[model samples]
Target: MPDKPRVILDSKQLELTINRLCYQLIENHDDFANSAIVGLQPRGVYVSKRIHEELAKMTGNKNIRHGALDATFFRDDFRTRETPRIPDVTELNFNVENLKVILVDDVLFTGRSVRASMDALLAFGRPQLVELLVLIDRRYTRHLPIMPNYTGKMVNTSLSERVSVEWKETEGKDCVKLHTVKK
Candidate 1:
């Protein structure tokens, strides 16, 4: 039999986490006039979009600007990987110049993605600040010194374990899980 996945957050918990995250974001960025929410592609896009929608609904501001960023080319391991990776769609219409940018993603692993995201974001105008938001913070796995400014959950796992986040946009349900191979 295959290794069973351990549930970290169920649908209810996921919703609550999202709502809490939205509230914390509002607490930090009231009205969000000087802030921009950018989601990392392709999995991070779901969390980013969810945050954008919830934050807009919470604040009743339809003009909350949200964008999607792809970090395929900016990744340090892209060229070194055996298989070639395809770039995803990047859709950021608004400029990030001098604005506080919140980078949203599903999980924070080795911190390489966040580093790559910073490089990718620099293609656009420079932002006054950039903060990271992740649904799951995998602690003690940082290949680089990166931490999430806003996190839904923090978990400690061994190197052999993997953390997976699923969303309704892609997985038809929202949940977080830890997966480990059966020895």
Candidate 2:
């Protein structure tokens, strides 16, 4: 049988983590004058939107450049998956050329999404810098050499487990959970 879901971050804890992440982003990208936050499409948008909103509230930069990227087609496994994938809308209104960019996502699983995001981002324009921000970083499972510059939490998991970030926007709550798959 599958293991019961484990709560990694509750609502209050999730809020605190996000607050701390926003401050960290501010510390590194002061003024955010030339930096943009791009949320990976699908699930990552929830975390990115929240981060963008928090950053605006804390930095008072109501004009922060935040956009969503859909890397469905850019994924390396796009042609290998048995199920077809539907593409999401990409709405990056600002140019990333010569700018610093932070890629945001709810969870960093195998790093494939991040890789695809980077590839998808290139179509916009080459940014001066590229960093990653994730609500949950699942260690030891990365197939690619990718890591988050800003992470809310780092978790160690096995191949039989999965970590997911739930947002109130879509899941009715803000929490992180780890699920175990039956072998």
Candidate 3:
């Protein structure tokens, strides 16, 4: 564990970023008319809801499906942790087959979590396409080639640093921060 760093995106900035991201998703895919938002659990879930709210206001439609996914079992580092936590339930009522899926996450770090999320998502159904939406794209040492399709910000960092994304739903605040381990 390491001491957290200074705040990056404050509450106001985070809201603006979320709105921009939702708008970008709509603009990127003209067929967002039939797309679904699937948030990777924990922070991603909160981001999905916020984006969904913005989308509803922009599109004037409230039918877009928002779902949550937990990738604990799918993670490659599951064995590394002494006590593996139980995975949260994945709930997506709509069929994902042939539907565009926007996988949302708070931060894009090592890409291992995104990879695990993909593995978990496959159990639901094969989607037509899966696009990643991340609030902070911290470009550190990546083990995989995974990249985010929609990014609010890109921060170059060292391997010893950590990016933290906080949302009101979970953290009682909306902000993004970068933490570095003190040597």
Candidate 4:
């Protein structure tokens, strides 16, 4: 049987969190005139898309640049993984040079993903500033030094636990769950 999932953020709460994150983004990058939002591909895109939509609505700037970044090749343990790694599509088409880039992701785990994302982003262009935005921040589990500039939730999880974020656009609903393996 599958392990029971502990509810972290339900649909209502998820919407609130997204809205809050969007407001926070607006607070920092007012009109996004000199900024862009890039979602770390695969899962981050879901969260990023929501933020992009809401922020655009809030700022009335539909021209705000949004892109997708795939960091599979940039991961440190790509070759070490038992399963073969397949890279996702990268759809960045704007110049990131001298702009403030916000990197959005679904879950902040070991900080390795953020590190790989930074490396991947550098290939596009050198930004004046880079900030992180995550739906869930898994605290005390980072292997590298990294933190999110805007966070929806802060969860303290054990090494054996897993944090999964589901979005309505893809998962049929929005929710954050903590899954513990059955012992």
Candidate 5:
């Protein structure tokens, strides 16, 4: 097993960020009533669910659609790994054709994952627009120009540093961490 990294965003900050993001999403989109939140599997899924719940509370309606997307197969580096993990099925019950789709993720790193996610999402249906929402935006060496429309926070770090996001679905905790690999 590999060594885990350091802790960055604690429980308090995580909750605060989520609330702020929820408000931002509501404020930015005038037609949020017809919007759908799609979370990238693993951490993104959890974050999306939380936001969905918050939106429902604020709007006093439970019609918000939440979807989970797994983009492992769509990754450009998929074939490079010796043993790649099989991707989970992408589940978007509603048609994305003319609806607003919000893509949620835990961390924004090289932007490769976001790029791959977009490719995977296109297979479902062409949406009117797609916005990115990320918990932590660690601006490092980005190969693509992808940017998050709703970002919780921005942290600067070296190429060797890593940002880990943990949620109840996977880690049974809600927090974000920053760690550096041992040289």
Candidate 6:
């Protein structure tokens, strides 16, 4: 039997975590003048939009560069998938060369998506620096060398368990949950 879904970060806690991440980003980027924020497409766009909005409100600069990137076509497993996956739109309209690029995503699992996102970014330009920021980092599950530079939360779980992040815009709520799948 599958176990009941466990709430990892509730709405209030998720907000707090996001706030902390914003502060950390501010501390490092300092006004984001030479930095670009790129949110991964599909689910990651929500978290990236929130972070971009918060950064604007906190820095008093609404002109910060923000875009969404879709890495579907660049994924290594794209050809192996049973169903044909549709590619999402890539919204990056600015150059990334010589700039600090921060990649935002909702979850960091096997690191395959992060790797794919990096490949997808090549069409824009080579960034001087690329950092990853994720809402949830599923520890000990990485299949690649990728790691999150800033993580909202670190969770430990078995390989069969799945983590899901819900946002107000998508699921009508903001929360992180872990589900046990019976294989």
RMSD of each: 1.1, 1.0, 1.8, 1.2, 2.1, 1.1
Stretches of candidate 2 exceeding 4 Å from the true structure: none
- With a 3 Å backbone cut-off (N, CA, C), the pairs that clash in candidate 6 are none
Q: How many residue pairs collide in each prediction?
A: 0, 0, 0, 0, 1, 0
Worst 10 residues of 4 by lDDT: 165-174
TM-score against native, each model = 0.96, 0.97, 0.92, 0.96, 0.91, 0.96
Q: Candidate 5: minimum summed lDDT over ten consecutive residues — where?
A: 1-10
lDDT accuracy of residue 40 in candidate 2 = 90
- Candidate 1 per-residue C-alpha lDDT over 49-154 given as tens digits, one digit per residue, 9 for 90 to 100: 9899998889999899899999998999976899988999999989888999999999899999899999999989899999999999998888998989999999
- lDDT of each residue in 1-183, candidate 2, tens digit only: 878999999999999999999999999999999999989988888888999999999999999999999998888886778998999999999999999999999888899889989999999888999999999998999999998999999999998998888888788998999999998
Report how far residue 183 has shifted in candidate 5, in Å.
1.1
Which residue pairs collide, candidate 3?
Answer: none
Considering only N, C-alpha and C atoms within 3 Å, which residue pairs clash in candidate 1?
A: none
Off by over 4 Å in 3: 1-4
lDDT of 1 at 125: 84
* Candidate 2 worst ten-residue window by lDDT: 72-81
| Per-residue C-alpha lDDT of model 5 across residues 110-165, encoded as one tens digit per residue | 99999999999899888999999998898876789998999998989788788888
**lDDT value, residue 40 of candidate 5:** 95
Alpha carbon lDDT of residue 81, candidate 1? 90
Q: How far is candidate 3 from the true structure (C-alpha RMSD, Å)?
A: 1.8
Q: Which candidate ranks first by lDDT, i.e. highest?
A: 6
Score residue 1 of candidate 3 by CA lDDT.
57
**Candidate 1 residue 66 C-alpha distance from true site, Å:** 0.3
lDDT of each: 0.92, 0.92, 0.86, 0.92, 0.86, 0.93
Residue 154's lDDT within candidate 6 is 94
TM-score of 4: 0.96
Model 6 per-residue lDDT at 59: 94
